[model samples]
Target chain A: MQVNKSDLLRRLKKIEGQVRGVQKMIEEDRYCMDILVQLAAIKSATHNIGLAILEGHTKRCVSNAIRSGDGEQAINEMMEVLRSFVK
Target chain B: MQVNKSDLLRRLKKIEGQVRGVQKMIEEDRYCMDILVQLAAIKSATHNIGLAILEGHTKRCVSNAIRSGDGEQAINEMMEVLRSFVK
Candidate 1:
Protein backbone atom coordinates (compact mmCIF):
# COMPACT_ATOMS: atom_id res chain seq x y z
CA MET A 1 0.00 0.00 0.00
CA GLN A 2 1.13 3.49 -0.74
CA VAL A 3 1.89 5.83 2.14
CA ASN A 4 0.01 9.05 2.62
CA LYS A 5 3.17 11.08 2.32
CA SER A 6 1.98 14.44 3.55
CA ASP A 7 0.03 13.05 6.48
CA LEU A 8 2.94 10.89 7.52
CA LEU A 9 5.52 13.60 7.15
CA ARG A 10 3.41 15.99 9.19
CA ARG A 11 2.83 13.45 11.94
CA LEU A 12 6.48 12.47 11.99
CA LYS A 13 7.57 16.08 12.23
CA LYS A 14 5.30 16.50 15.21
CA ILE A 15 6.85 13.41 16.81
CA GLU A 16 10.32 14.77 16.11
CA GLY A 17 9.39 17.94 17.93
CA GLN A 18 8.00 15.95 20.83
CA VAL A 19 11.18 13.90 21.07
CA ARG A 20 13.27 17.05 21.13
CA GLY A 21 10.99 18.45 23.75
CA VAL A 22 11.73 15.45 25.92
CA GLN A 23 15.44 15.92 25.37
CA LYS A 24 15.17 19.54 26.43
CA MET A 25 13.13 18.52 29.43
CA ILE A 26 15.86 16.14 30.44
CA GLU A 27 18.58 18.77 29.89
CA GLU A 28 16.68 21.18 32.09
CA ASP A 29 16.60 18.52 34.83
CA ARG A 30 12.88 18.29 34.71
CA TYR A 31 10.99 16.03 37.10
CA CYS A 32 11.18 12.30 36.41
CA MET A 33 7.41 12.02 36.26
CA ASP A 34 7.29 14.74 33.65
CA ILE A 35 9.84 12.97 31.54
CA LEU A 36 8.01 9.67 31.79
CA VAL A 37 4.79 11.36 30.76
CA GLN A 38 6.47 12.84 27.72
CA LEU A 39 7.94 9.51 26.77
CA ALA A 40 4.48 7.95 26.96
CA ALA A 41 3.22 10.59 24.59
CA ILE A 42 5.95 9.73 22.10
CA LYS A 43 5.17 6.04 22.43
CA SER A 44 1.51 6.66 21.66
CA ALA A 45 2.31 8.93 18.72
CA THR A 46 4.47 6.26 17.19
CA HIS A 47 1.81 3.65 17.83
CA ASN A 48 -0.75 5.75 16.02
CA ILE A 49 1.57 6.09 13.08
CA GLY A 50 1.92 2.34 12.99
CA LEU A 51 -1.83 2.01 13.01
CA ALA A 52 -2.10 4.40 10.11
CA ILE A 53 0.40 2.43 8.11
CA LEU A 54 -1.31 -0.81 8.98
CA GLU A 55 -4.61 0.61 7.87
CA GLY A 56 -3.20 1.45 4.51
CA HIS A 57 -1.56 -1.93 4.15
CA THR A 58 -4.75 -3.74 5.10
CA LYS A 59 -6.82 -1.64 2.76
CA ARG A 60 -4.47 -2.29 -0.12
CA CYS A 61 -1.93 -5.11 0.18
CA VAL A 62 -3.95 -7.53 2.25
CA SER A 63 -7.08 -6.91 0.24
CA ASN A 64 -5.27 -7.50 -3.02
CA ALA A 65 -3.71 -10.69 -1.73
CA ILE A 66 -7.11 -11.98 -0.71
CA ARG A 67 -8.56 -11.10 -4.08
CA SER A 68 -5.75 -13.05 -5.68
CA GLY A 69 -6.62 -16.08 -3.49
CA ASP A 70 -3.38 -15.79 -1.46
CA GLY A 71 -5.40 -14.64 1.53
CA GLU A 72 -4.24 -17.12 4.17
CA GLN A 73 -0.55 -16.31 4.05
CA ALA A 74 -1.16 -12.61 3.87
CA ILE A 75 -3.57 -12.72 6.78
CA ASN A 76 -1.11 -14.84 8.77
CA GLU A 77 1.71 -12.43 8.11
CA MET A 78 -0.41 -9.52 9.17
CA MET A 79 -1.47 -11.28 12.35
CA GLU A 80 2.14 -11.95 13.21
CA VAL A 81 2.95 -8.32 12.71
CA LEU A 82 0.00 -7.32 14.84
CA ARG A 83 1.22 -9.65 17.56
CA SER A 84 4.49 -7.76 17.62
CA PHE A 85 2.58 -4.52 17.83
CA VAL A 86 1.12 -5.18 21.25
CA LYS A 87 3.07 -3.65 24.08
CA MET B 1 15.07 11.41 41.38
CA GLN B 2 17.49 13.01 39.00
CA VAL B 3 17.61 11.84 35.39
CA ASN B 4 20.77 10.24 34.10
CA LYS B 5 21.69 13.08 31.81
CA SER B 6 24.34 11.55 29.56
CA ASP B 7 22.50 8.26 29.08
CA LEU B 8 19.21 9.94 28.24
CA LEU B 9 20.76 12.48 25.91
CA ARG B 10 22.56 9.70 24.12
CA ARG B 11 19.41 7.67 23.71
CA LEU B 12 17.41 10.67 22.61
CA LYS B 13 20.07 11.52 20.06
CA LYS B 14 19.75 8.01 18.68
CA ILE B 15 16.00 8.38 18.60
CA GLU B 16 16.36 11.69 16.81
CA GLY B 17 18.46 9.94 14.18
CA GLN B 18 15.86 7.21 13.84
CA VAL B 19 13.11 9.74 13.35
CA ARG B 20 15.13 11.45 10.67
CA GLY B 21 15.71 8.09 9.02
CA VAL B 22 11.96 7.55 8.89
CA GLN B 23 11.53 10.96 7.30
CA LYS B 24 14.09 10.04 4.69
CA MET B 25 12.33 6.76 4.02
CA ILE B 26 9.09 8.61 3.47
CA GLU B 27 10.77 11.02 1.06
CA GLU B 28 12.14 8.10 -0.90
CA ASP B 29 8.73 6.44 -1.05
CA ARG B 30 9.72 3.34 0.82
CA TYR B 31 7.43 0.37 1.37
CA CYS B 32 4.68 0.68 3.96
CA MET B 33 5.74 -2.47 5.79
CA ASP B 34 9.28 -1.18 6.21
CA ILE B 35 8.10 2.14 7.58
CA LEU B 36 5.70 0.37 9.94
CA VAL B 37 8.50 -1.79 11.25
CA GLN B 38 10.66 1.25 11.87
CA LEU B 39 7.81 2.92 13.72
CA ALA B 40 7.58 -0.17 15.93
CA ALA B 41 11.24 0.18 16.76
CA ILE B 42 10.70 3.81 17.69
CA LYS B 43 7.78 2.80 19.86
CA SER B 44 9.89 0.24 21.70
CA ALA B 45 12.73 2.70 22.19
CA THR B 46 10.41 5.28 23.66
CA HIS B 47 8.88 2.61 25.88
CA ASN B 48 12.35 1.81 27.17
CA ILE B 49 12.99 5.46 27.92
CA GLY B 50 9.79 5.57 29.89
CA LEU B 51 10.84 2.45 31.76
CA ALA B 52 14.19 4.01 32.63
CA ILE B 53 12.60 7.15 33.98
CA LEU B 54 10.06 5.05 35.82
CA GLU B 55 12.88 3.03 37.33
CA GLY B 56 14.59 6.12 38.69
CA HIS B 57 11.35 7.53 39.94
CA THR B 58 10.47 4.26 41.65
CA LYS B 59 13.89 3.70 43.13
CA ARG B 60 14.30 7.20 44.42
CA CYS B 61 11.06 9.14 44.70
CA VAL B 62 8.82 6.24 45.56
CA SER B 63 11.31 4.79 47.98
CA ASN B 64 11.79 8.13 49.66
CA ALA B 65 8.10 8.68 49.86
CA ILE B 66 7.67 5.30 51.46
CA ARG B 67 10.51 5.86 53.89
CA SER B 68 8.97 9.18 54.83
CA GLY B 69 5.68 7.33 55.46
CA ASP B 70 3.63 8.71 52.56
CA GLY B 71 3.90 5.49 50.59
CA GLU B 72 0.27 4.97 49.68
CA GLN B 73 -0.42 8.06 47.65
CA ALA B 74 2.98 7.97 46.01
CA ILE B 75 2.58 4.40 44.93
CA ASN B 76 -0.93 5.13 43.77
CA GLU B 77 0.25 7.95 41.56
CA MET B 78 2.95 5.82 40.08
CA MET B 79 0.43 3.08 39.35
CA GLU B 80 -1.82 5.55 37.63
CA VAL B 81 0.99 6.67 35.37
CA LEU B 82 1.84 3.07 34.67
CA ARG B 83 -1.71 2.31 33.64
CA SER B 84 -1.23 4.77 30.83
CA PHE B 85 1.94 3.04 29.71
CA VAL B 86 0.18 -0.05 28.38
CA LYS B 87 -0.59 0.07 24.65
Candidate 2:
Protein backbone atom coordinates (compact mmCIF):
# COMPACT_ATOMS: atom_id res chain seq x y z
CA MET A 1 0.00 0.00 0.00
CA GLN A 2 2.89 2.35 0.62
CA VAL A 3 4.71 1.77 -2.67
CA ASN A 4 4.59 3.97 -5.75
CA LYS A 5 1.83 2.18 -7.69
CA SER A 6 1.77 3.77 -11.13
CA ASP A 7 4.46 1.43 -12.44
CA LEU A 8 2.60 -1.55 -11.04
CA LEU A 9 -0.54 -0.40 -12.81
CA ARG A 10 1.37 -0.16 -16.06
CA ARG A 11 2.65 -3.72 -15.65
CA LEU A 12 -0.93 -4.83 -15.15
CA LYS A 13 -1.88 -3.17 -18.41
CA LYS A 14 0.82 -5.07 -20.26
CA ILE A 15 -0.38 -8.29 -18.69
CA GLU A 16 -3.89 -7.51 -19.88
CA GLY A 17 -2.51 -7.03 -23.35
CA GLN A 18 -0.74 -10.39 -23.15
CA VAL A 19 -3.98 -12.04 -22.14
CA ARG A 20 -5.73 -10.50 -25.12
CA GLY A 21 -2.94 -11.71 -27.38
CA VAL A 22 -3.47 -15.23 -26.13
CA GLN A 23 -7.17 -14.92 -26.89
CA LYS A 24 -6.31 -13.92 -30.45
CA MET A 25 -3.97 -16.89 -30.75
CA ILE A 26 -6.76 -19.17 -29.60
CA GLU A 27 -9.21 -17.71 -32.08
CA GLU A 28 -6.77 -18.15 -34.95
CA ASP A 29 -5.95 -21.70 -33.86
CA ARG A 30 -2.29 -21.02 -33.47
CA TYR A 31 0.01 -23.87 -32.45
CA CYS A 32 -0.64 -25.08 -28.93
CA MET A 33 3.03 -24.75 -28.05
CA ASP A 34 2.98 -21.09 -29.03
CA ILE A 35 -0.04 -20.42 -26.87
CA LEU A 36 1.58 -22.30 -24.01
CA VAL A 37 4.65 -20.10 -24.25
CA GLN A 38 2.55 -16.97 -23.99
CA LEU A 39 0.64 -18.34 -21.04
CA ALA A 40 3.94 -19.09 -19.30
CA ALA A 41 5.08 -15.56 -20.01
CA ILE A 42 1.92 -14.18 -18.44
CA LYS A 43 2.47 -16.32 -15.35
CA SER A 44 6.01 -15.03 -14.97
CA ALA A 45 4.91 -11.45 -15.59
CA THR A 46 2.39 -11.69 -12.79
CA HIS A 47 5.01 -13.32 -10.59
CA ASN A 48 7.38 -10.41 -11.08
CA ILE A 49 4.66 -7.91 -10.33
CA GLY A 50 3.82 -9.75 -7.15
CA LEU A 51 7.48 -9.82 -6.18
CA ALA A 52 7.75 -6.08 -6.71
CA ILE A 53 4.71 -5.48 -4.55
CA LEU A 54 6.08 -7.70 -1.80
CA GLU A 55 9.49 -6.04 -1.82
CA GLY A 56 8.08 -2.51 -1.80
CA HIS A 57 5.57 -3.34 0.88
CA THR A 58 8.19 -4.93 3.10
CA LYS A 59 10.69 -2.12 2.77
CA ARG A 60 8.10 0.57 3.42
CA CYS A 61 4.90 -0.66 5.05
CA VAL A 62 6.28 -3.37 7.30
CA SER A 63 9.17 -1.28 8.52
CA ASN A 64 6.98 1.71 9.19
CA ALA A 65 4.50 -0.42 11.11
CA ILE A 66 7.29 -1.88 13.23
CA ARG A 67 8.63 1.58 14.01
CA SER A 68 5.16 2.67 15.05
CA GLY A 69 4.72 -0.41 17.34
CA ASP A 70 2.03 -1.79 14.99
CA GLY A 71 4.19 -4.49 13.51
CA GLU A 72 2.20 -7.45 14.83
CA GLN A 73 -0.93 -6.83 12.82
CA ALA A 74 1.03 -5.87 9.71
CA ILE A 75 3.19 -8.96 9.93
CA ASN A 76 0.17 -11.19 10.45
CA GLU A 77 -1.56 -9.75 7.41
CA MET A 78 1.55 -10.13 5.30
CA MET A 79 2.03 -13.75 6.32
CA GLU A 80 -1.51 -14.64 5.31
CA VAL A 81 -0.99 -13.17 1.92
CA LEU A 82 2.37 -14.88 1.62
CA ARG A 83 0.67 -18.19 2.33
CA SER A 84 -1.77 -17.47 -0.44
CA PHE A 85 1.11 -16.66 -2.77
CA VAL A 86 2.68 -20.07 -2.23
CA LYS A 87 -0.66 -21.78 -2.73
CA MET B 1 -3.94 -27.10 -31.36
CA GLN B 2 -5.96 -30.26 -31.13
CA VAL B 3 -7.56 -29.52 -27.80
CA ASN B 4 -11.24 -28.78 -27.41
CA LYS B 5 -10.86 -25.04 -27.60
CA SER B 6 -14.19 -23.58 -26.54
CA ASP B 7 -13.50 -24.35 -22.90
CA LEU B 8 -10.02 -22.90 -23.18
CA LEU B 9 -11.47 -19.74 -24.68
CA ARG B 10 -13.89 -19.49 -21.79
CA ARG B 11 -11.01 -19.89 -19.37
CA LEU B 12 -9.11 -17.12 -21.13
CA LYS B 13 -12.05 -14.78 -20.86
CA LYS B 14 -12.22 -15.41 -17.14
CA ILE B 15 -8.49 -14.71 -16.83
CA GLU B 16 -8.92 -11.47 -18.74
CA GLY B 17 -11.64 -10.47 -16.32
CA GLN B 18 -9.32 -11.30 -13.44
CA VAL B 19 -6.64 -9.08 -14.91
CA ARG B 20 -9.15 -6.24 -15.18
CA GLY B 21 -10.14 -6.87 -11.58
CA VAL B 22 -6.52 -6.43 -10.51
CA GLN B 23 -6.31 -3.19 -12.45
CA LYS B 24 -9.35 -1.91 -10.61
CA MET B 25 -7.82 -2.88 -7.29
CA ILE B 26 -4.69 -0.94 -8.15
CA GLU B 27 -6.66 2.12 -9.22
CA GLU B 28 -8.61 2.01 -5.97
CA ASP B 29 -5.36 1.95 -3.95
CA ARG B 30 -5.95 -1.46 -2.47
CA TYR B 31 -3.51 -2.95 0.06
CA CYS B 32 -0.23 -4.07 -1.47
CA MET B 33 -0.30 -7.51 0.10
CA ASP B 34 -3.86 -8.00 -1.11
CA ILE B 35 -2.79 -7.05 -4.59
CA LEU B 36 0.09 -9.49 -4.33
CA VAL B 37 -2.37 -12.25 -3.53
CA GLN B 38 -4.38 -11.45 -6.63
CA LEU B 39 -1.27 -11.53 -8.78
CA ALA B 40 -0.32 -14.91 -7.36
CA ALA B 41 -3.79 -16.19 -8.14
CA ILE B 42 -3.44 -15.00 -11.72
CA LYS B 43 -0.16 -16.84 -12.05
CA SER B 44 -1.70 -20.08 -10.83
CA ALA B 45 -4.72 -19.65 -13.05
CA THR B 46 -2.45 -19.36 -16.04
CA HIS B 47 -0.50 -22.40 -14.90
CA ASN B 48 -3.63 -24.50 -14.74
CA ILE B 49 -4.69 -23.34 -18.16
CA GLY B 50 -1.28 -24.15 -19.55
CA LEU B 51 -1.49 -27.61 -18.06
CA ALA B 52 -4.84 -28.17 -19.68
CA ILE B 53 -3.51 -27.13 -23.07
CA LEU B 54 -0.43 -29.28 -22.72
CA GLU B 55 -2.39 -32.36 -21.71
CA GLY B 56 -4.82 -31.97 -24.54
CA HIS B 57 -2.13 -31.24 -27.11
CA THR B 58 -0.02 -34.23 -26.07
CA LYS B 59 -2.82 -36.74 -26.12
CA ARG B 60 -4.10 -35.66 -29.52
CA CYS B 61 -1.49 -33.75 -31.47
CA VAL B 62 1.58 -35.60 -30.25
CA SER B 63 0.06 -39.01 -30.82
CA ASN B 64 -1.15 -38.04 -34.26
CA ALA B 65 2.27 -36.71 -35.14
CA ILE B 66 3.90 -39.95 -34.07
CA ARG B 67 1.38 -42.01 -36.01
CA SER B 68 2.07 -39.90 -39.09
CA GLY B 69 5.85 -40.37 -38.55
CA ASP B 70 6.24 -36.66 -37.81
CA GLY B 71 6.76 -36.90 -34.08
CA GLU B 72 10.29 -35.61 -33.74
CA GLN B 73 9.42 -32.07 -34.71
CA ALA B 74 6.30 -31.97 -32.63
CA ILE B 75 8.16 -33.35 -29.65
CA ASN B 76 11.03 -30.91 -30.04
CA GLU B 77 8.60 -28.03 -30.24
CA MET B 78 6.76 -29.23 -27.16
CA MET B 79 10.04 -29.50 -25.28
CA GLU B 80 10.94 -25.92 -26.15
CA VAL B 81 7.63 -24.66 -24.86
CA LEU B 82 7.94 -26.77 -21.74
CA ARG B 83 11.33 -25.23 -21.10
CA SER B 84 9.78 -21.80 -21.38
CA PHE B 85 7.08 -22.85 -18.95
CA VAL B 86 9.67 -23.65 -16.32
CA LYS B 87 11.42 -20.39 -16.84
Which residues of candidate 1, in runs, are more than 4 Å off?
A1-3, B1-3
Model 2 misplaced stretches (Cα beyond 4 Å): A1-3, B1-3
Q: Could you report the Cα RMSD, in angstroms, for every candidate shown?
A: 2.3, 2.4
Q: What is the lDDT of residue B34 in candidate 1?
A: 79
Query: Residue by residue across A1-87, what tens digits does model 2's lDDT show?
Result: 435677888888999999999999989989888899899989999988888788888898999999999999999998889888867
Query: For candidate 1, lDDT tens digit of each residue in B6-43?
Result: 89898999998899899999899787777877888898
lDDT of 1 by residue, A1-87 (tens): 234788889889999999999999998888888778788888998898889888988998899999999999988888877777764
Query: Model 1: DockQ against the native?
Result: 0.73
- Separately for all candidates shown, the number of backbone clashes (residues 3 or more apart, or on different chains) is 0, 0
Model 2 CAPRI rating: medium
Q: What is the interface RMSD of candidate 2, in Å?
A: 1.2
